[model samples]
Target: MAKIGINIATGSLQQEEMIVGIDLGTTNSLVAIIHPESKKPVALKEHNSSSLVPSIIHFGEDGAVSVGETARNYLVNDPANTIFSAKRLMGKSYDDIRKNASFFTYKVIDDNSDSLVKVQVGDKFYSPIELSAFILKELKTRAEHILKTPVSKAVITVPAYFNDAQRQATRDAGKLAGLDVLRIINEPTAASLAYGLGIHKEDEKTIAVYDLGGGTFDISILRISNGIFEVMSTNGDTYLGGDDFDHAIVMKWIREHGIDATQVEQDKMLLQQLRLKAEEAKRHLGQKDVFIDHVGKYQLQITTSEFEKLIDPLVKKTLEASERALKDAGLTTADIDDVVMVGGSTRVNLVKKEVARFFGKPLHASLNPDEVVALGAAVQAEILAGNNKDFLLLDITPLSLGIETMGGLMDVLIPRNSKIPTRIARQYTTQKDGQSGIKISVYQGERDLVKDNRKLAAFNLTGIPSMPAGLPKVELTFLINADGILVVKAKELRSGVEQAIEVKPQYGLTDEEVESMLMESIVHAKEDIAIRSLVEAQTEASQMIDTTVAFINKNREYLEEAEIAATTNAIDQLNQSIATGTKDEIQARIEALNELSRPYAERVMDLAIAKAMKGKKI
Candidate 1:
């Protein structure tokens, strides 16, 4: 007897696999796929329902997880347990978000360290990766339900200005959600693809993508040739978007109604309600000339002219960013063949007029702005699956390449899916004073820690002149040839000591073996991330303990007994936490120790400076 695979939901033969395209957006998310029958990209949706899914997550008292419209309802009544705008938090540290911390309604832990930030709800801590995973999982489930097939592979889109860490975080989220992310493409590029800008081999054109999403705005200049799209330059304010337009209305209403600003600031629920009203007004003014509403004793009315005037400054900001992008790309507005508008906010009449005036051309917004990216992603997925043979797809590296650095962290030199035959160099330093030798261990994977990845090769560069730590510069260069062979070279700049190694990155590996390795990596993605975080926390704690002990021993005479005792106690607590506690617990203890020692360290530096100045003459 032969075994036949079948889909339980649709009773169809599960023979051909489907790869989906996903728009994991800040305000909303959705999935799209190429229709096998029509040969067109269409967003997956249920009967008579819209495609957009609110990118919100809510945790209930029973520890049940909810997403989309169900979770959006909890924003006002259970704000602390709900997470939104998680894309803004991706790959960011506490210091990165300190200035805008109040923008979030939930608690964001402030450990003052350089590690990724975490949100606290009740007693549970969640990283931005985990939060985003919930959204992706929701989209995956929806695609599976609508297509009646098991969806496992996807191509996700991101902003053109997103850094490497942010892109990696998105990939990790997809893996955690049980999706094998085949590629991470720029949202601007995806938008252009949806408009059929890069499908022809002879089509040579320069285009501009002006995207104004719910929480961010960016303008990108791109050049397309022979079905290849390359971003020339990108610029925008990550903190400015349509949300600010709503905020402008709220401020205007407060001024007109003579509402107590202090009272509104103190009441989160009331503030949320006003924000919702402002959003409604913004949407209503798009089609009507005026909006009228009353909440409590305050009557609010906003006209189209007033709404346009309030957002003029923001519109001008986008134009300025466009000018800068053009300047950086060394191209004038005349060089652009087309200008594309993306995001729901672009539907505003004023925005369209201003953008047209700036570019001196009509806009390309024929498709729904909210769904264009997902549609393009679906097209890219089609190409990846070899179903669309008209467009040429370039070869890409299968895994990330990096070297082991201090604290056992994997500092990526070349990210995965990068164009082939590329070379990049980075500088590193010795961690110990008078260190004469350095070991270069190369690894391949997506994990932050080197231990969780596959070791490719290792070499040692010896003979460095005795110098203080961080004085010796070691330049490491990675070059991948046309045949996918990697050559790693390391050289001590000051001493002229060099070492080199060659490894065939794709040697002796069958296609099935590679697939198995990819599957295993995705299967263990969450655990790998957790282990990496714990190791980093432990490394930081150990380093802090050593430094504090050394400082106390050397400056005993400058410190009071009570201060020394407190500092010692804090160090002891941190060590204990490092032994058995979670990353957040260990980080909290480390922060406590820093708070206890910072003042004394500053005082000691001040006294030393004073004594030195006393002996010297001006």
Candidate 2:
């Protein structure tokens, strides 16, 4: 029988039921189930007992695929088939992808996808949502498998810097993955939850979370007291992160080694190898004073001092962002109770040292930096489930929600840092003589020029009884919900005719575009699965061969030579089938290979048991 994995269905479950909280990070993702009784959040474990799944999805040639840890292993070798760090591209355009092409290991292609960046993997294209859904789906499965029940309600976290379109895209991805996204919590806020969950004081204390993750950076200043978390201010570079720091290290490596990587893009394999090398050096410098390596054709050894020197400028950029966040919050460093460090990037010794120098206090990383956001999310889930009665979180909009005015100036309505579930009203007048309709363009950003910011949507104030210039008065109000989605409405003040404005986001997927993308993804899902399964089957076959080799040494007296020969033959056939990228053949050979190695697996288990018994006897 072909096994099928059951997924958690979407929507609100029974009221008072425990809700799940997810940290959908750029480098990794985790799902935690809140215990209704204890109000504790437990990170869900995979089928094989691993938590904290890597945010990677590998597409195979057969109608089979793998995600998370198994998929991340295929990244360096099958860069084309494996999509990693796609979180940065969600809701972004081809133009944005082009600007940071050098930082990625995959091929960012300009395809016929209506100006949206389409990731070309081998011969197929995948939208960012589809890729992200695969990751989300994997997390959902892990949670369902762990709890033995469906996890319907969840709060997903995103970078505070994600714009309206990006947040919408994230929610859409959650929907596609069949999870009811109760809320989209900002990453920094989630970190605060992890830090301040059990603390409730009468007086408020301002805390800051400096979250520099794999593909994005965010600095959020939050105020907390008596279980209320109010995000005071937030600032970040959406496109910046630890990946950029690694790129700085890579460029330095090239200069120190006298090798040029500007031309390495022509050779995708070498580029992939170099990126892996660069990443290793960056990680190494975290623990050691020096790094030594030969990354394919390039041979270079870099001292920690040299690497730090190269990345000092990038670190400075983060400091500048932190300062901006503090200024935005109208607070000084002394006002902060603690500066919390979240994200694996905080492991960098230099990052910690510099943060301490800037803040005049040693950075706090008491919680698992990688898991705090997810843990905090779990706390939110508990609160949402009515289990944590004392908790209430108030997340503010990261960017000013506004509209384009005359001469392309931004007419901000609801400024950044405004509390959620708030509304602001603005009055609009007729543009010119006898103007029948007033076209209103909505934008979101801190930019002074409309062109420099993101165009959220545009709608018209119509049915204006065509009066002479300056005679009509139209009232427009932008209401932001708790979810942070903007709702715009306009009313002809004199005529009392009101119409809800429908504005299309500049880089957002329209209804038709989304439908087309789903169809395309469905059609291509099989091909991608096939390619990935072929590689995975071969990898499995190789591991089986190694295990058999070890098993034969211990059980040679009990096994027949022909049994060993058959196992070897089956593995060879599977390896050969993997190269052909034939899904059916690979599946058949893999099954045969697994069958042939079953005896050896059992024998190895027996041997381990016998050794344990011997130890007990001693």
Best by lDDT: 1
Using TM-score as the measure, the top candidate is 1
**What is the number of residue pairs that collide in model 2?**
11
TM-score of 2: 0.60
**Model 2 lDDT tens row, 138-221:** 888877666657665578998776776677667657756766566777877787777763345464777889988887778888
Structural similarity to truth (TM-score) of each candidate: 0.90, 0.60
Across 484-556, the per-residue lDDT of candidate 1 in tens digits comes to 9999999999888889999886556576766776777777777876776688778778877877788889889
Question: Any runs in candidate 1 off by more than 4 Å, and if so which?
Answer: 1-15, 59-62, 78-80, 122-124, 405-416, 424-429, 445-454, 463-475, 491-499, 598-618
10 residues in a row with least lDDT, candidate 1? 6-15
Tell how far residue 146 is off in model 1, in angstroms: 2.7
